[model samples]
Target: MPRKFKVTVNNVDYDVDVLEIGAGSPQAMPSYTPIAAQIAPISSVPAAAMVAAAPSAKTGPAGAGDQCAQMGGVVVNIPVKQGHSVNEGDVVVELEAMKMKVPVIADRSGQVARILVAVGDGVENGQALLTIA
Candidate 1:
């Protein structure tokens, strides 16, 4: 594709046509290119590893996991269960994101009334992770 550019140097004005390289032009694309990449066979991964990759269902108490707060990543661990007493700053859940593990701590001293998410569940940046009651 050719892009036009205008430049002024000193008192002279110039218009230039620049040719873009690579894929910007439709002609650069192959007509028969596949719509998706082909995935390799999963034989290399152990069955246990594949199973561990999945997140489990929500565990412990019912009724909207109260005091839901936003946190993003995969629930890697739930160290505190429902009815467990905790103090402010006690780790309740551990999240894994971008190859880093982050511990979700108790915001206030109270019993963990519910564990809304289970291990392996994907979380959003502002989605509720759990509640303290």
Candidate 2:
């Protein structure tokens, strides 16, 4: 018996076939089939919309945005807010991902100009968390 699975990696789709054999004869050539593309993360937040003159666009450094989380997660808390002073390594925002709480820290000492994410809001990688200026 054989099973076929379609997998996607880095937006590239690939089809794979797996065969099971017992104490029988040898195997021959395997088969492959390509499938359609899977859902993309880009659809969550369009790059064009991020670059536009939106409220979230003013979140980080140089009026661009704050240092975003390296991974996507739900914002659990925002310890820092506008007009609040923070030092490097200070816990700014906490994110819950994979059932673990991840703390987002400040990289430099500065006054928080804006807090981009609110508690319970879903955030994406490279998305603004807060602005320090």
Give the per-residue lDDT digits (tens) of candidate 2, residues 1-133: 7899999999999999987666554544444454434445666878887678444422333344365776788999887768988888899899999999999888888898877678999987667788888
TM-score of 2: 0.53
Best by TM-score: 2
TM-score of each: 0.49, 0.53
Candidate 2 error regions (>4 Å): 1-65
lDDT of 1 by residue, 1-133 (tens): 6999998999899999987767677868657745444554688688999999975434333234353324567888888888888888888888888898988767788888766788998876555666777
Cα error, candidate 2, residue 28 (Å) = 22
